[model samples]
Target: TYAETKFIEAEAEFLVANSGSFQATGANAAAYEAYLEGIRANMDKLGVSQADRDAYLSDPNVAVGTANLTMELIMKEKYKALFLNPETFNDLRRYNFDDTIFRGLELPEDHNSVLNGQWIQRAVYPSSEFSRNEDQVRQAEKAIDQPMWFYN
Candidate 1:
Protein backbone atom coordinates (compact mmCIF):
# COMPACT_ATOMS: atom_id res chain seq x y z
CA THR A 1 0.00 0.00 0.00
CA TYR A 2 2.82 2.38 0.84
CA ALA A 3 4.55 1.54 -2.40
CA GLU A 4 1.42 2.15 -4.41
CA THR A 5 0.88 5.55 -2.82
CA LYS A 6 4.50 6.43 -3.42
CA PHE A 7 4.19 5.55 -7.07
CA ILE A 8 1.16 7.79 -7.48
CA GLU A 9 2.92 10.61 -5.69
CA ALA A 10 5.92 10.16 -7.91
CA GLU A 11 3.75 10.33 -10.97
CA ALA A 12 2.25 13.62 -9.83
CA GLU A 13 5.72 15.04 -9.25
CA PHE A 14 6.88 13.87 -12.65
CA LEU A 15 3.90 15.62 -14.20
CA VAL A 16 4.78 18.93 -12.57
CA ALA A 17 8.36 18.59 -13.73
CA ASN A 18 7.44 17.56 -17.23
CA SER A 19 4.88 20.29 -17.69
CA GLY A 20 7.20 23.22 -17.44
CA SER A 21 10.59 24.83 -17.34
CA PHE A 22 12.02 25.57 -13.85
CA GLN A 23 12.26 29.28 -14.49
CA ALA A 24 8.89 30.39 -13.18
CA THR A 25 8.47 33.80 -11.55
CA GLY A 26 6.07 35.15 -8.90
CA ALA A 27 4.28 32.74 -6.63
CA ASN A 28 3.64 30.21 -9.36
CA ALA A 29 7.14 28.74 -9.39
CA ALA A 30 7.43 28.87 -5.63
CA ALA A 31 4.16 27.06 -5.06
CA TYR A 32 4.87 24.41 -7.68
CA GLU A 33 8.41 23.77 -6.49
CA ALA A 34 7.19 23.51 -2.92
CA TYR A 35 4.68 20.89 -3.94
CA LEU A 36 7.27 19.00 -5.92
CA GLU A 37 9.69 19.00 -3.04
CA GLY A 38 7.03 17.82 -0.65
CA ILE A 39 6.17 14.86 -2.83
CA ARG A 40 9.78 13.86 -3.42
CA ALA A 41 10.61 14.22 0.25
CA ASN A 42 7.65 12.15 1.23
CA MET A 43 8.75 9.39 -1.09
CA ASP A 44 12.22 9.50 0.39
CA LYS A 45 10.84 9.47 3.88
CA LEU A 46 8.79 6.47 2.95
CA GLY A 47 11.89 4.70 1.67
CA VAL A 48 10.86 4.57 -1.95
CA SER A 49 13.66 3.27 -4.13
CA GLN A 50 15.62 5.60 -6.36
CA ALA A 51 14.91 3.16 -9.15
CA ASP A 52 11.20 3.84 -8.85
CA ARG A 53 11.73 7.56 -9.06
CA ASP A 54 13.95 7.05 -12.08
CA ALA A 55 11.36 4.93 -13.79
CA TYR A 56 8.81 7.72 -13.64
CA LEU A 57 11.33 10.45 -14.44
CA SER A 58 12.63 8.60 -17.46
CA ASP A 59 9.34 7.85 -19.13
CA PRO A 60 9.64 8.75 -22.82
CA ASN A 61 6.05 9.79 -23.37
CA VAL A 62 6.23 12.41 -20.63
CA ALA A 63 6.61 15.83 -22.18
CA VAL A 64 9.74 17.54 -20.90
CA GLY A 65 10.70 20.87 -22.37
CA THR A 66 12.95 23.48 -20.85
CA ALA A 67 11.82 26.38 -23.00
CA ASN A 68 8.23 25.62 -23.79
CA LEU A 69 6.96 24.82 -20.33
CA THR A 70 4.09 27.09 -19.35
CA MET A 71 1.17 27.49 -16.98
CA GLU A 72 -1.12 26.00 -19.61
CA LEU A 73 1.00 22.89 -19.85
CA ILE A 74 1.12 22.58 -16.06
CA MET A 75 -2.65 22.95 -15.91
CA LYS A 76 -3.08 20.21 -18.51
CA GLU A 77 -0.89 17.93 -16.45
CA LYS A 78 -2.87 18.88 -13.35
CA TYR A 79 -6.06 18.01 -15.15
CA LYS A 80 -4.69 14.59 -15.96
CA ALA A 81 -3.51 14.09 -12.40
CA LEU A 82 -6.96 14.93 -11.12
CA PHE A 83 -8.71 12.27 -13.16
CA LEU A 84 -11.74 10.89 -11.30
CA ASN A 85 -11.36 13.47 -8.53
CA PRO A 86 -14.40 15.66 -7.82
CA GLU A 87 -12.20 18.76 -7.95
CA THR A 88 -11.63 17.99 -11.61
CA PHE A 89 -15.15 19.16 -12.35
CA ASN A 90 -14.51 22.46 -10.59
CA ASP A 91 -11.22 22.78 -12.42
CA LEU A 92 -12.94 22.28 -15.74
CA ARG A 93 -15.50 24.92 -14.88
CA ARG A 94 -12.90 27.43 -13.69
CA TYR A 95 -10.46 26.98 -16.53
CA ASN A 96 -12.15 28.27 -19.61
CA PHE A 97 -11.91 25.65 -22.30
CA ASP A 98 -9.37 26.29 -25.00
CA ASP A 99 -11.25 25.07 -28.03
CA THR A 100 -8.08 24.35 -29.98
CA ILE A 101 -6.86 21.85 -27.39
CA PHE A 102 -10.22 20.52 -26.22
CA ARG A 103 -12.10 20.30 -29.51
CA GLY A 104 -9.51 20.76 -32.27
CA LEU A 105 -11.41 23.75 -33.61
CA GLU A 106 -12.05 27.41 -32.93
CA LEU A 107 -15.12 28.53 -31.03
CA PRO A 108 -18.10 29.01 -33.33
CA GLU A 109 -19.17 32.55 -34.23
CA ASP A 110 -22.17 32.14 -31.93
CA HIS A 111 -19.84 31.97 -28.95
CA ASN A 112 -19.78 35.77 -28.94
CA SER A 113 -23.56 36.04 -28.94
CA VAL A 114 -24.84 37.68 -25.74
CA LEU A 115 -26.47 34.45 -24.65
CA ASN A 116 -23.14 32.64 -24.91
CA GLY A 117 -20.74 35.19 -23.54
CA GLN A 118 -19.43 34.41 -20.06
CA TRP A 119 -21.35 31.93 -17.94
CA ILE A 120 -23.88 33.26 -15.44
CA GLN A 121 -21.81 34.51 -12.54
CA ARG A 122 -24.17 32.99 -10.04
CA ALA A 123 -27.35 31.02 -9.71
CA VAL A 124 -30.68 32.65 -8.94
CA TYR A 125 -32.34 31.68 -5.71
CA PRO A 126 -35.57 29.68 -6.04
CA SER A 127 -38.49 32.07 -6.47
CA SER A 128 -40.53 30.60 -3.59
CA GLU A 129 -37.62 30.77 -1.17
CA PHE A 130 -36.79 34.30 -2.33
CA SER A 131 -40.32 35.42 -1.67
CA ARG A 132 -40.16 34.09 1.90
CA ASN A 133 -36.75 35.66 2.65
CA GLU A 134 -37.22 38.88 0.74
CA ASP A 135 -34.57 41.18 2.18
CA GLN A 136 -31.78 38.63 2.65
CA VAL A 137 -32.46 37.01 -0.71
CA ARG A 138 -32.41 40.32 -2.52
CA GLN A 139 -28.99 41.11 -1.06
CA ALA A 140 -27.67 37.76 -2.12
CA GLU A 141 -29.16 38.17 -5.59
CA LYS A 142 -27.11 41.30 -6.17
CA ALA A 143 -24.12 39.01 -6.71
CA ILE A 144 -25.91 36.79 -9.21
CA ASP A 145 -24.82 38.59 -12.39
CA GLN A 146 -21.44 39.72 -11.11
CA PRO A 147 -18.29 38.08 -9.88
CA MET A 148 -18.34 37.35 -6.17
CA TRP A 149 -16.55 39.78 -3.90
CA PHE A 150 -13.63 37.42 -3.55
CA TYR A 151 -13.26 37.05 -7.30
CA ASN A 152 -13.45 40.79 -7.75
Candidate 2:
Protein backbone atom coordinates (compact mmCIF):
# COMPACT_ATOMS: atom_id res chain seq x y z
CA THR A 1 0.00 0.00 0.00
CA TYR A 2 2.78 2.36 0.91
CA ALA A 3 4.48 1.69 -2.39
CA GLU A 4 1.32 2.47 -4.31
CA THR A 5 0.83 5.73 -2.45
CA LYS A 6 4.46 6.68 -2.99
CA PHE A 7 4.10 6.00 -6.70
CA ILE A 8 1.08 8.27 -6.84
CA GLU A 9 2.84 10.97 -4.89
CA ALA A 10 5.86 10.72 -7.16
CA GLU A 11 3.64 10.89 -10.20
CA ALA A 12 1.90 13.97 -8.86
CA GLU A 13 5.20 15.62 -7.95
CA PHE A 14 6.54 14.84 -11.39
CA LEU A 15 3.50 16.47 -12.99
CA VAL A 16 3.86 19.50 -10.75
CA ALA A 17 7.51 19.76 -11.65
CA ASN A 18 6.67 19.33 -15.29
CA SER A 19 4.02 22.05 -15.25
CA GLY A 20 6.42 24.38 -13.49
CA SER A 21 8.74 24.00 -16.44
CA PHE A 22 6.42 26.15 -18.55
CA GLN A 23 7.65 29.12 -16.58
CA ALA A 24 10.87 28.83 -18.58
CA THR A 25 11.68 30.25 -22.03
CA GLY A 26 10.95 29.00 -25.56
CA ALA A 27 13.46 26.15 -25.51
CA ASN A 28 12.37 25.08 -22.03
CA ALA A 29 8.72 25.18 -23.02
CA ALA A 30 9.44 22.88 -25.96
CA ALA A 31 11.30 20.48 -23.71
CA TYR A 32 8.53 20.45 -21.11
CA GLU A 33 5.86 19.87 -23.72
CA ALA A 34 7.81 16.89 -24.93
CA TYR A 35 8.11 15.65 -21.38
CA LEU A 36 4.36 15.88 -20.80
CA GLU A 37 3.68 14.09 -24.07
CA GLY A 38 6.02 11.34 -22.99
CA ILE A 39 4.20 11.03 -19.70
CA ARG A 40 0.86 10.68 -21.48
CA ALA A 41 2.30 8.03 -23.76
CA ASN A 42 3.75 6.09 -20.86
CA MET A 43 0.50 6.28 -18.94
CA ASP A 44 -1.25 4.81 -21.93
CA LYS A 45 1.32 2.05 -22.13
CA LEU A 46 0.69 1.33 -18.47
CA GLY A 47 -2.94 0.49 -19.34
CA VAL A 48 -4.56 3.72 -18.28
CA SER A 49 -7.55 3.59 -20.60
CA GLN A 50 -8.38 6.21 -23.20
CA ALA A 51 -11.56 7.16 -21.41
CA ASP A 52 -9.76 7.80 -18.10
CA ARG A 53 -7.07 9.75 -19.85
CA ASP A 54 -9.65 11.82 -21.66
CA ALA A 55 -11.52 12.33 -18.43
CA TYR A 56 -8.44 13.76 -16.83
CA LEU A 57 -7.57 15.81 -19.87
CA SER A 58 -11.11 17.14 -20.25
CA ASP A 59 -11.87 17.93 -16.64
CA PRO A 60 -12.73 21.61 -16.49
CA ASN A 61 -11.69 21.88 -12.84
CA VAL A 62 -8.15 20.77 -13.70
CA ALA A 63 -7.57 23.31 -16.43
CA VAL A 64 -4.85 25.87 -15.77
CA GLY A 65 -5.44 28.09 -18.81
CA THR A 66 -2.71 27.45 -21.38
CA ALA A 67 -0.95 25.43 -18.72
CA ASN A 68 -3.75 22.76 -18.79
CA LEU A 69 -2.37 21.28 -15.53
CA THR A 70 -1.84 22.35 -11.96
CA MET A 71 -0.70 20.90 -8.66
CA GLU A 72 -4.25 20.04 -7.56
CA LEU A 73 -5.03 18.41 -10.87
CA ILE A 74 -1.86 16.38 -10.77
CA MET A 75 -2.57 15.39 -7.17
CA LYS A 76 -5.96 14.05 -8.23
CA GLU A 77 -4.27 11.97 -10.89
CA LYS A 78 -1.82 10.73 -8.28
CA TYR A 79 -4.59 9.67 -5.94
CA LYS A 80 -5.91 7.47 -8.71
CA ALA A 81 -2.46 6.09 -9.44
CA LEU A 82 -1.89 5.18 -5.80
CA PHE A 83 -5.22 3.40 -5.40
CA LEU A 84 -4.90 1.61 -2.03
CA ASN A 85 -1.40 2.23 -0.81
CA PRO A 86 -0.61 2.96 2.84
CA GLU A 87 2.43 4.94 1.70
CA THR A 88 -0.08 7.68 0.99
CA PHE A 89 0.40 8.39 4.70
CA ASN A 90 4.02 9.26 4.03
CA ASP A 91 2.95 11.58 1.25
CA LEU A 92 0.48 13.16 3.64
CA ARG A 93 3.23 13.57 6.22
CA ARG A 94 5.63 15.13 3.76
CA TYR A 95 2.91 17.51 2.65
CA ASN A 96 2.05 18.17 6.31
CA PHE A 97 -1.57 17.40 5.64
CA ASP A 98 -2.27 14.06 7.29
CA ASP A 99 -5.09 15.63 9.26
CA THR A 100 -6.96 17.84 6.85
CA ILE A 101 -9.91 17.72 9.25
CA PHE A 102 -8.01 20.07 11.53
CA ARG A 103 -6.84 22.21 8.66
CA GLY A 104 -3.32 22.62 10.17
CA LEU A 105 -4.65 23.52 13.61
CA GLU A 106 -3.29 20.29 15.17
CA LEU A 107 -0.77 17.57 14.39
CA PRO A 108 -0.06 14.05 15.57
CA GLU A 109 2.23 13.91 18.60
CA ASP A 110 4.55 11.00 18.07
CA HIS A 111 7.88 9.93 16.61
CA ASN A 112 6.38 10.75 13.25
CA SER A 113 5.91 14.36 14.30
CA VAL A 114 9.68 14.52 14.57
CA LEU A 115 9.58 14.33 10.80
CA ASN A 116 7.78 17.66 10.67
CA GLY A 117 9.88 19.26 13.37
CA GLN A 118 13.52 19.38 14.55
CA TRP A 119 13.94 16.10 16.47
CA ILE A 120 13.70 13.96 13.37
CA GLN A 121 16.87 15.52 12.04
CA ARG A 122 18.61 14.26 15.17
CA ALA A 123 17.23 10.74 15.47
CA VAL A 124 18.97 8.14 17.63
CA TYR A 125 21.50 6.02 15.82
CA PRO A 126 20.85 2.34 15.20
CA SER A 127 20.64 0.06 18.22
CA SER A 128 23.12 -2.27 16.51
CA GLU A 129 25.80 0.02 17.84
CA PHE A 130 25.42 -1.61 21.28
CA SER A 131 26.73 -4.98 20.08
CA ARG A 132 29.73 -3.86 18.01
CA ASN A 133 30.73 -0.65 19.78
CA GLU A 134 29.68 -0.20 23.39
CA ASP A 135 31.55 3.03 24.10
CA GLN A 136 30.23 4.71 20.96
CA VAL A 137 26.78 3.41 21.83
CA ARG A 138 26.92 4.97 25.27
CA GLN A 139 28.02 8.32 23.84
CA ALA A 140 25.22 8.25 21.29
CA GLU A 141 22.71 7.30 23.94
CA LYS A 142 23.71 10.39 25.91
CA ALA A 143 22.86 12.52 22.90
CA ILE A 144 19.69 10.67 21.88
CA ASP A 145 17.04 13.09 23.11
CA GLN A 146 19.02 16.25 22.38
CA PRO A 147 18.61 18.49 19.36
CA MET A 148 21.17 18.78 16.59
CA TRP A 149 22.81 21.86 15.10
CA PHE A 150 20.00 22.30 12.61
CA TYR A 151 17.46 22.39 15.40
CA ASN A 152 19.37 25.15 17.18
Name the best candidate (by TM-score): 1
lDDT (C-alpha, whole model) for all candidates = 0.45, 0.44
Give the TM-score comparing model 2 with the true structure, all chains together.
0.37
Best by lDDT: 1
lDDT of 1 by residue, 107-148 (tens): 455653543566444456888977699889876675433544
Predicted structure 1: lDDT? 0.45
Q: Give, for candidate 2, the lowest lDDT window spanning 10 residues.
A: 22-31
Provide the lDDT at 112 for model 1. Answer: 35
Candidate 1: residue 132 Cα off by (Å): 6.7
Give each model a TM-score.
0.38, 0.37
Candidate 2 lDDT, 3-60, residue by residue in tens? 2434344444444556534222222233334434434554675778888866755556
Listed per candidate, the RMSD to the true structure in angstroms reads: 8.7, 8.1
Worst 10 residues of 1 by lDDT: 20-29
